[model samples]
Target: MSLDLGMTNAPGSTPRAPGRLGVPVSAAEALRYLTDLGMWLDERRKQLDAIDQAALSAPDQSDREALTHDITVSMALWKAISDRYELLRVTFDSGRVGPVQAEQLSTLIWGRLDVAPGDGREATRARMPSGAESNLAVSLPEACRLSDAMSSSLRARLALETTGLDVSIRVKGIRESVERIRDQVSMMPLGATRDRTQRELIALEQRLFDVTERAKRGADVGGFLGPLEVEVAARERDLIVAASRRHESERDAARARELITALAARGDAIRGLQAQCLAAVTPAPKLAVPDVRALGAVPDDPDAIDALLARLGLVGKALDQAHETYARALGERDELQGLLGALDAQVAGSPAVTAAERADLKPMRDQLAAVLAATPVPLVRARALMAAYQSYVRTVTNNGRAPL
Candidate 1:
C-alpha cells in the first residue's frame, strides 16, 4: 500500500484542520471521522512496527539511536491521537452525545493534553526519557500531524539513508560509473584520445582504491565521496560525447542518441519545474540539476551505451529528489496563503465580529496579504502575521470566552 497514510499535509501545504467536535457535533459526522481515524491509526501502527524493525536492524549504534528516538516520538504521538480517538468513539458509538459531552470531546480533540507512555506493558518496554511524562504533551490534531510527518521522514531515511550501507552503496554506484566511463573510453579509436582517457581511468582507479581503503579503516571519507562521484560522472559524459562523434555502428549510435535525447527532454522538464518552484517560494532548495546534454551524443558502442543508460538512471533519481524538494516548498507556500485567506474570511463572517473590530483587524490582514502577494512570498513573515491575526481576532471577538 502507498505510505501516504494519515492526516499528512502534502510537501509544502499546510495541514488540514481537524474535524471540530464542538457543541452539536453530528452523530453521523462524528462516526465517520472516528472510522477514518481508526483506519489511519491502523496504518500508523503498521508504520510504527516497520520503523521499530528498522531501528533494530540499523547498521550502527548511531543509526540505531536516531531511529530509536524517532520510533519513540512516533509512538508517543500515535498513542496520544489514538487515545482521544477511542474516547470519542465510545461516546459517539452509544448514540447522540449531549452538549456537555460534546464540549468535553472538543477539549479532548483540541486541548493540549499529557502525552506519555502509559503504565502498561508497552509503556514499560518503551523506557522513555526521564521525566518524559511531564514534558511531552500535544493536542490530538498536533499528535496526528506530527506522527504523519515523522513517519514520512523516517520512511525516507529507511529507504535511502541507512548509514550502515550508505558508504558501500555510494562506493558501488561510483564504481559502476567509473566502469561505464571505461567502456566508453575503450570504444575510442587508438591515439591521443584513447591514451589520455586510459590515463584518466588509471587515476580514477587509484583514487577509488584509496577511498576504499579509508572506508575499511573507518575513516570519514564522506567529504571525498561526492567529488569522486561527480568526477566519474563527468568523465563518463565526456567519453560518451567523444565516442558519439566518431564514425561507428549506425544502429548502436542511433540507440544511444535516442536515449540521450529522451534524457535531455526529461532534464528540461525537471529544470522547468525547478524554475517554477524557485519563483513560487522564497528560500527554495539550492540543488544542482544534472543535465543530460552534458553527456554528449549517443556513442556507437553497445557497452558504452549501456553504461550511459546506468548514468541516466542516477540522473533520474537526482532529478526526482530535486522535484520533490521544490514541489514541497511551493506547496507549502500556497497552503499557507490559502490558510491566511481562509482565516481572514472566517473572521470577517463571524457573527460576533463588529465593524470596529474588523477595522482593528484590517492592518494585520493587509500586511499578511501584502506578504503573500509578494514575489517569492516570505513564508516566515506571512506565518507570523497569520498567527497574530488569528490571536488578535480571538481577543477582539471573544475576549472573556473560552477558545473553541
Candidate 2:
C-alpha cells in the first residue's frame, strides 16, 4: 500500500525536511515531493549562476579560488540532485511505475549519490585508488544543505570585499580632492587667509592618513570616511568661492577706474554747462553736482568695491539730474525768446492801432527786447513786459470789445 508523506505547502526557500529512509510513500506523494524539490533546485541554480559569475570576475586570486571552489561544489551537487529528480519525474509520468519505481525514488531522496570529481588539474593530480580521493556521496537533503551553507558563506565574503573596495575608492577620492584643494590654496595670495586655509588642508590630510592606515590594518573606517569627504568637499568649495570673489573684485576695480575717468570728464563738462546756463538765464535751478573725487580710489576688498560701485552709480544719477536741470533752463530761455519774437512781429503788422499808439508801444517793446537780449535775461521781467504788450495790442485791435 502507498503511504502519504508530509511536504511543505510551497517550494519556497524554507529548509527541506530530512528524507524518510526506507519509508513506504505513495507514487503520487513521491511525485509531489520530486516536483517541490525541482522548484527548490531551480532557485538554487539561479543562486549558483550568480556565484559563478562573481567567482569568475573576482580580482583577487585567493578570493577567486575560494569562491570557485564553493561554486564548483554547489553546482556539481545541484546537477546530481537535478539529474536524479528529472529521472524520477519522467519515470512516474510514464504510468509504468510499480513498487520498484517507488523504492527507487525514496532511495534517491534518502540515499547517497556519487558526485563526479571536478575536472580541475588539482583534483586530477590528487586522484587516488580505493576511492580515497573519489567523488563525494551525499543524500539530496544533505547536498541542498551544503549548497545553502556555501552560498551564505560566499555572500558574506563578497559583502566584506565589496565594503573594502568601497572604502578604498572613497580614500582615493579624498586624496584627489585634497590635492585639488591644495593647488587652489597655493594660488591664493599670501596672507593670513591663505595660511589659515593651508593649515586646515594639512589637518584634513593628517586625518585622511590616519583613516588610510586604519583601513590598511583591516579596521572599519566607514565612520571616518564620510566626515572626511565632507570636510574636503567643503574646503574645495570655499576655495572656489574665494577665487570667484577675487576675480569679481579685480573686475570691479577696473570698472571703477574707467568710471572715474568718465565721471571726471562728465563733471567738467557739466560744470561748464552750469556756468553758461546760469549766465544765460535768470532763476536757473541750483543743483549740486556730485564730486567723484570724494569717493576716492576703489578698494581691494570685495565689499568695499561693491560699495564704491554703488556710490559711483549715485554720482552718475546726480550728474544726470543736474545736466537735465541746467539744459532745461537754457531751453526755456530759448522758447521765451521765440515767443517774444513772434508776438513783436504780430503787433507790428497789425493795422488796428494808430501811429500815435504805435509810438507809445515802441518804448515797452524796446525794454522787452533788451531784457531778452541781455546775458542774464530776467524771465520774470520779460514775461511781465510781454504780457503787457500783448494786452495793449489786444485792446486796440478789439476796440475795447472781446473778439468773436
Candidate 3:
C-alpha cells in the first residue's frame, strides 16, 4: 500500500495499525520512501522557480536571500535522501540488507526528511505532519540499531550518483564571485578609464540579470556566467592599472609639497643670518636668493629642487658652522661685558663673597672688557672669553641662594 507521510501527523499510513509510526521496515520499503520524498522536493523546487519568475522586476533583497537559502537547503536534503536510497538498493541487491540493517537505514531517512527547518514552511499546501516536532532534534532510543552514540554502523559510503552532472555547486561559486566583483566596483577610485568601466559594469549587470532568468527557467547557468566572469576580470585589471597611475601621480604631488616646505625653512634661515655672514668677510660673494614664495613654475622633481637650493645659497655642514659663528660674534662681546660689570658690582657690595673670590673674577672680566673694546672683536676669542666669564659668574653666584 502507498504510505503518505507528513512531518507531524498520524504516523501510520494505508492499512497499517492506528497510532503506529509508518517507518519502512525493509530495504524495498525504505527505497520507496526516499523516492516519494524526491518527488515532493521537485514540486517545492518548481514553486520556488515560479516565485523567481514573479519577482523578476523590482526584486526584494531579503526575499532573494531567503529564496537562495531555501533552494540550497532543499537541494541538500533531496541529495541526502537519494544517496541513502541508492545505498539501500545496492545493499539489498548484494543480499546484505538484513532486517535489522534495513530498519536502521529507514530510521535515518525518516529523521532527516520528516522535519522542516525552523522558519521554513509549505504555504500553498498543508503537510500531514505539522513539522513543529523536528525529528533531528528528538534523541533516538539507545536500543535503536544506528543510535549507538559511538562506533556507529553509518560509517559506510553510499552509492554515488553518476547518471547526470550536478551544476548547482558551479552556479553557487560564480554567483559568489560576481558578488565580490560588484563590491569592488563600488570602491574603485575614479580615473581616465572609470567612465568606460562604468559602461562595462552596466553590461555586466545585464548579463547577471540574464543569468538569473536562465537559472529560473532551468537552463544552463555556467554558460551564461562564464562570459560574465571574463568581463568582470577584465574590468578589475583595468581598475588596477588606473589605480597604479593615480598612486604615481599622488607621490609626485606629495614630493612637490615637501620641496615648498624646505624652501620656506631655508628662506627664514638665510634672511636672519646672511647679512651678518657677508659683513664679517672682507670680500663677500654676491648672493641672489630666489623668491621662495613663488613656486607656481617649479618642477616636482626632488633632485632638481635640491640643486636649485644649493646653488642659491651656502649650505651643508660649512653653512651650519658659519651660522654658529655669526650668532656668537653678534652678541657675545656686549652680553659678556654687561654680565661682568654686574658681577663686579655684586662682589663689591656682597657680605657672602670674600676679597680672594673678587680677585680671581677680575682677570676674566678684564679680558672680556679688552675684547669688547676691539672694533669687530674676533669671534673665536669673544666666544672663548664669554664662556670663561659665564662659568666664573655662576661659581660666584652659586644659584644666588648661598655665600660665594
Candidate 4:
C-alpha cells in the first residue's frame, strides 16, 4: 500500500503520536539536524586543516609526526559521523506513511537520538529527553534499535579516534620540549662539550625520524620514545664547552693586560734614562776672571820653584783631558742628531740626497788601493815640524823688531 508520509503541522511543532516507520519529519527538525551535522563536519575539517598547518610549520621530524597523528584521528572521527548519518537517511527514505505515522516516527527518532549536552544547564535540560512515562511512549518502533546500534558503533570509533588524538598531542608536546632544549644547548660556543652535544642531537633527530616513520605506518604508539635521553646528553656537553671557552677567553685577556702593564713600565724607565743622559751632556757657560797681583816679592828657592813648575804641568794635562772628553761628547751628539734628521726625511718621503747618503757600504772593496795609500811613518815627525815652526816664529818676531 502506498503511504502518505506528510507532517500534519508546521516543522518542530510537537508530534501527536509515536512508533511507526516512513513518517515525514518536521522540515524545521530536519533542517536543524542537517545544520548541526554540517557544523560538526566543518569543525572536524577545521581541525584537520589546523593539523596540516602545524605539520608544515613544525621544525623537526617529531613535531611533524605528531601533527600527522592528529590529522588521522580527526579524519577517522569525521568518517564515522558521516557514515552513521548516511545510514540513518537511507533507512528513513525507504518507507513512506501518513502524517500521524510521520509524527510517530519523529518522536521515535528523538527518543533514540543522544543529544549532546550544551554549555548552559537550562538549555541542555530543555533539549534533552527524559526517561519518563509520556516521553517513553513517544519512541518509534524500530528507530531505537537502529539508533542504539549506530551509537554503539560511533562510540567505539570515537574511542579509537580520541586515543590516537591524545597520543599524537602528547608526542608533539614532548617533541617541542626536546627541541627547545636543543636550541638552548646548541647556542653554546664550540668546544668538547659542544661537539658532544651536537653529536647527541644528531642521534636524537635520527631516532625521532624513525619514530615518525613508524607512526605514519600505523605502528605501535610505544615505538615513539628516547629523544629525551639524547637531548639531556647534548645539553650537558654544550654546557661544558661553553664553560671551557669562557675560561679560556678570561685567561687570554688577563695575560694581555699584564703584558701591556709590563711594557708601559719598561717604557717609563727608558724615558728616565734618556732624560738623565740629556742633562749630563748639557754645556755650562765659561766665566771671565780678573788677573791677581803677587802678594809679596821674595827670594826664590830652586827646589820650591821646581815643585811649582811640576804642579803647573799636571794642571795643564788635566785641562787637556777635560777638553777632549767635551769634544767627543759633542761629536757623538752631532752624529745622533744627523741620524734623527735622516730618519725624519725618510719618513716624510723625502730621503736625504747626498753622496754619503747614497753611498753603499762595502767591506774591503779596494784592499789594494788602501794598502798603496798607506804612508810610512817618519820618526820624530811631529817634533821636527814643531821645532821648525817655533824657529820661524822667532825669526819673524826679530825681523819685525816690535817687542822681545
Which is the leading candidate under TM-score? 2
Per-model TM-score, in order, reads 0.35, 0.54, 0.32, 0.21
lDDT (10s digit) by residue, model 3, range 1-404: 11111211111111111112335456555455445544544543343343334333324666544344333333333334345546645555644567666665655543323223322344332221112122222211111111110001000001011113244543443354345445545656666445666676777767777887888898866555545544553344334333333443455456556655776686568656667645553233345444455545444443465454554343333444545655655555556567667766766676755678778878878887777666545656766887777677667666466532
Per-residue CA lDDT of candidate 4, range 289-342, in tens?
A: 111111122113323443434444454454444444544544444443454344
So what's the TM-score on candidate 1? 0.35
Instruction: Output the lDDT of residue 204, model 1.
Output: 98
Query: Which TM-score value belongs to model 2?
Result: 0.54
Clash number for candidate 4: 5
For model 2, residues 1-404, the per-residue Cα lDDT tens digits are 11111221111132454348786446767756766787777777766666566667778988786555545655666778778777767767654558876677677676766566452335533221122244555566655544444444444345322332467766776676677678888889999999898899899989999999999999998778756655665465446445545655687799999998899899889999999998998887899987798888778887789888998999999999999999998987887788777766766666777888888888988888899899898878887988887777676666555632
Mind giving the per-residue lDDT tens digits that candidate 1 earns over 60-126?
A: 8888876665567568767777777888877775667777666666666766655565433354544
Best by lDDT: 2
Better structure of 1 and 4 per TM-score:
1
Off by over 4 Å in 1: 1-259, 391-404
Count of backbone collisions in candidate 3: 3
